[model samples]
Target: MTDTKTVLITGGSRGLGRNMALKIANKGLNVIITYHTNKAAADNVVAEIIKTGVNAKAFQLDTSNTASFDAFFTDVEAYLKSINKTHFDYLVNNAGTGIYVPFTETTEAQFDDMMNIHFKGVYFLTQKALNLMNDNGGIINISSGLARFTFPNSSAYASMKGAIETFTKYVAKELGARKINANVVAPGAIATEFGNGENKTNETKRGLVANVTALGRVGEAEDIGGIVAFLCTEDAKWINGQRIEASGGCML
Candidate 1:
């Protein structure tokens, strides 16, 4: 039950972030979404959210480039103050990317990119955004089920996701003084640009994942989006620092 009411979602141009933005905006909440590269896609999402009779906008952001974070926060602060506001209500660190290279073949550049985008970005962005959030506000970090399972080529990527979950716990502890909530949302085998139709191959091992999933199919972006929206709702105030997997029971 926060008085300051606005939600900022990273990677909100497409996939799960886009769906989450639309859902929250439909509930009459102010939304500020960020995109790494796809401006057109972000604008499209903003348009859809506005159609729901709510306020929503998109800003360009590169999660891997942490140097620009301060400027981004500055812009967000200015926008909120213009509306006679001082703090945001929630933050969703959903911006991330992936590379399907074996550990032995993974280059330094690739490893750095994944770590920067998945872990470092979430860490520093949260640090910067926390000061601008209101009491009882929510913080959600998007994780992957690959962090829990043994997915060979996903070692580097999954390791970063693992770090994010751990970081969420510490954030919850530190931000507790302000009564803000922080948690992790892990999704399994989602049908997104990260590794959907384009990356399909015989060697891409998701057979075990598919066979073990009780839902009998991979997840869609909206599946995770809906869960994220629920987590930020008033009903989810007690949920903090926990990893809630929206995997449809993938691998039990």
Candidate 2:
């Protein structure tokens, strides 16, 4: 039961990010969330987080807009100054886009889109955020089980995720002096709007993924949210530069 601290989660407007914000906010942490589009949705998430009697707010952010990372960091610093908080305790680099194309059909544009969103964005975002983060703060990059397992249409996505895991290790090693911890969370196929439409997941496909899982059910948003929340707690203070997979043994 560590003292509640501030947490910033990107793409926190809906889907897994929204769920994670709710879970973290309920634990008495101040939530500063970001969304790429849909200001209305971001506002709704903020309202929900506040309903739990915790401090929460949302901002517009496009992670793929890597050129704006510095400006975004400035905005975050300004927000922190307004709140009189010196440093934030957690950063979840959860904002990302998905692409599904056969290896033969995947074009250069498609490959670049996935790489920019998943790898390049996470890389610069963490670099910018580290300066503003508190000592002993935690960073959780959202990877996917595909990083380790082979998936036909997910070559690009999985490759980027693998890159994230490597980046986490490097971040952890370099930031050790500050007591900062960086880690990755690899989730199995979950029911989220990540790969498809907004707020709509492929129920049948998700169920099939669950059937292959040891748990016999697709993962819910809360399933991953809860894990991310825990990593910020003192209980995980010693866990750094590691990849924790919450896939119910999927593909095992």
Candidate 3:
């Protein structure tokens, strides 16, 4: 058997990312989470995962800024060496924030933020990480259900997810030589601290979402975490270039 697998997740200080880190740790994968400014919260997550008996660490990463990726990976490599490893096993591109602006009202800055964090960041991060990913390892890019169904104020964000879906397919195809598989995980409306906590705090919005969702409510962060963890496990080895939407049957 190989050494313990490690997963690098962006934006894992809290919310769905936090839940995913914990769930993946429960499966015996070492975890490395990135936070933009919440080092305290990120440290807390590391501590929580350590209690699960898996190795964990947190690093500062602003996913939107490509200029810092080189330095970021340098630190990651140093950390991996300290653990007697040379590469990570999986990459989960989950760092991002949602902007609630209509298409007409969306500014160039808003569009760029969405593009940088969702598409460009995922694209280049995976490119650089490929050097450090084990053969036959996998990648999971976080998309959103909005890419399938329409929602107000999400045009830019959804467009990027659509791009991710397309990019993932290409990654799977090109990386076939290396046996590195890539897939997208598109989550439906989830109740988390993400996106200013709209799904969690907007009671009227929650009522409307519940009316349309077959599951009768917005999805919890826990609902999506396990699916991500499963993809990182051996059971999902054959799954590649697939867009798995964990949206609890919403808008169906």
TM-scores, all candidates, are 0.93, 0.94, 0.98
lDDT per model vs. reference = 0.85, 0.86, 0.93
Q: How do all the candidates rank in terms of lDDT, highest first?
A: 3, 2, 1
What is the C-alpha lDDT profile of model 3 across 161-181, one tens digit per residue?
A: 999999999999999998888
Give candidate 1's total backbone clashes: 0
TM-score-better candidate, 1 vs 2? 2
- Candidate 3 ranges beyond 4 A from true positions: none
Which residue pairs in candidate 2 collide?
Answer: none
Error in Å for residue 146 of model 2:
0.5
Per-residue C-alpha lDDT of model 2 across residues 157-202, encoded as one tens digit per residue: 8889999999999999999999999999998877787887422466
Tell me the tens digit of each residue's lDDT in model 1 across 86-171: 88889999988878789999999999999999998888999899779888899999998888876678889999999999999999
Query: How much is 154 displaced in model 1, in angstroms?
Result: 0.1
TM-score of 2: 0.94
Output the lDDT of residue 24, model 1: 81
Q: Which stretches of candidate 2 lie over 4 Å from their true place?
A: 1-4, 197-204
Itemize residue pairs with steric clashes in candidate 1. Answer: none
Q: TM-score rank, highest first?
A: 3, 2, 1
